[model samples]
Target: MLNQDVLRNARSPGRGFAAAKRGFDIAVALLALPAVLGVAAVLLLLNPIANRGPLFFVQARMGRNCKRFTIVKFRTMSAGQPEGGPAPRGPDDPVEDERITPLGRMLRRARIDELPQFFNVLSGDMSVIGPRPDVWDHAIHYLDSVPGYRARHTLRPGITGLAQVRGGYAEGIRATVQKTREDLAYIDGLSPRMELYILLRTVQVVFTGKGAR
Candidate 1:
């Protein structure tokens, strides 16, 4: 059965794992705050020269069970839209494309751009590990187009996850379907060991810049 004890709300499959997972997320987030915030602070100081943009890129995102919440991240793009339109749908998430500054690109590759999201994790708006949250607009599109996409939100969104490690940045609808499958798989296969494995893989991805934009 799906885990009824979500973080302050609904979560997905597994009996007692939901509560345990939230606890782990909280513990990790607490432990990580000092270092992560320090790095973010350092980056904030350097943003003028390297990034030349706002300190953060805040946006509404789809969280567990389709709940909307604001997700915060280090700004990787300029203050406005890349152009007068929405970020395009195809080709490896155009949100990360031409609009992204070079330093922003580096931040994304290193996963440093998302460090501020630890705050989101602490706020119960996210998780330490689970399906990564999608931007509200894009997530709306996927909900209509991709099968099982809604089910992927069975748990709080994560900073990193199986889809992020295995599937990387999913592009269009086909890739999103794959991402949804991995998300559901992660939900179904919840365990301390599995969570640990994902966390370790996240470390590797951070250092090696593999499977990152």
Candidate 2:
């Protein structure tokens, strides 16, 4: 029998799963932070001219259930932008080609720009594996465009996830929409196995430097 209660409850947030995932997040972040921080230090030394003095960049991102939190990252672009910087384009457009400094390019390509987000995970603002967070502006735009976008918020935003594994920083609206569908799919089919798969695939991408940039 299809349990309506189960299906209905599934539509809501999974507090138990989230709590368990938080444990996983903390364990992984603790294990990975040393290496991540070491690399960040090296990058900061190499890219002192970029982003002025800041080695780490932090920004407000909408997290699980539309909660706002500061997400940390390695600085990748200059602090200032012209009046109208490069407009968002499709996945094929080179979004970083203009805004990214040479060092920034390497950071983005290596996915090191996102290392500091581990701190977010440790702080309970994010998860190890789930939908990625977005800025408020982009989150609002996407929720308006995508029907089930809010469903993803039932779980904490992840540093790496199904959408990210499938579409690392998609450049176009169409690609974003496609990635949105993949994120929703993940929400509907949440499980430890799936999470591990996404994490493993994400690691593969990072090592191969594929689908990143």
Candidate 3:
């Protein structure tokens, strides 16, 4: 039988952990805010000529326990499109190649598109470490296709994590499942030390421009 009680107990420590992580996030975000905001402002200024309209975009995403929250990102596509043309997919999705704007492509390559998520972290809708969030549409789709997909939601979503550093955009169900395993592995070993390791690796990867679209 499924040990719901054990799983429930597993999260009893989360409230304390969440408080600690929030403090850490606030400290880091405050330290990085000047730089982060500068970069985002520069990008917004350039976007008019590059991508055009809407400095930031928000979409409904699923978070812990399948709760809904709006995710923020730099707009990387033209504002106008045919109704129901195509939904935003993962970075690796073939459709992404078609819908992304020229300047949007560059934003994604440099990960500038994700800059707005810092606010999400500060707001406690996300974290600096954990599995990435998915749009509710994608979440629904994955729940049907991938085993234990919801397990990743045991904690808040993150801007960077084992999955992002390992395999940027899930290639397919197999890849997604693999990423889920990594997320679960992280959950099993969650700690400040382990999170520091993941964060360090994430910084290394970002600087080196590795495993990014």
Model 3 agreement with the true structure over 1-213: per-residue lDDT tens digits: 223433333331377886888788778767767877897789767877877777777887779887889888877877765211125554234534566888887777777778788889888898878888876766777777766677778888888888888777665566777777677767767888888888888888777777655
Q: Model 1: per-residue lDDT, tens digit, 1-213?
A: 223332223236465777888888889889988988788788878888987767876788899889999988888776675321234543334444777778888888998878888899999999989899887777888887876678788888999999998878876667777787778777767778888899888888899898776
For TM-score, the strongest prediction is 1
- For candidate 2, the lDDT comes to 0.73
Model 2 poorest ten-residue lDDT run? 82-91
The full ranking of all candidates by lDDT, starting with the best, is 1, 3, 2
**Which residue runs does candidate 2 get wrong by more than 4 Å?**
1-16, 49-52, 82-96
Number of the candidate with higher lDDT, 1 or 2: 1
Give lDDT tens digits, candidate 2, residues 74-176. 8777666421123243223445456667777787788888888888888988888888886655666667665566666877888988988877776445666
Cα RMSDs, all models: 4.9, 4.6, 3.9
Candidate no. 1 TM-score = 0.86
- The per-model lDDT (C-alpha) reads 0.78, 0.73, 0.73
Alpha carbon lDDT of residue 184, candidate 2? 70
lDDT of 3: 0.73
Q: List ranges where model 1 is wrong by over 4 Å.
A: 1-15, 82-93
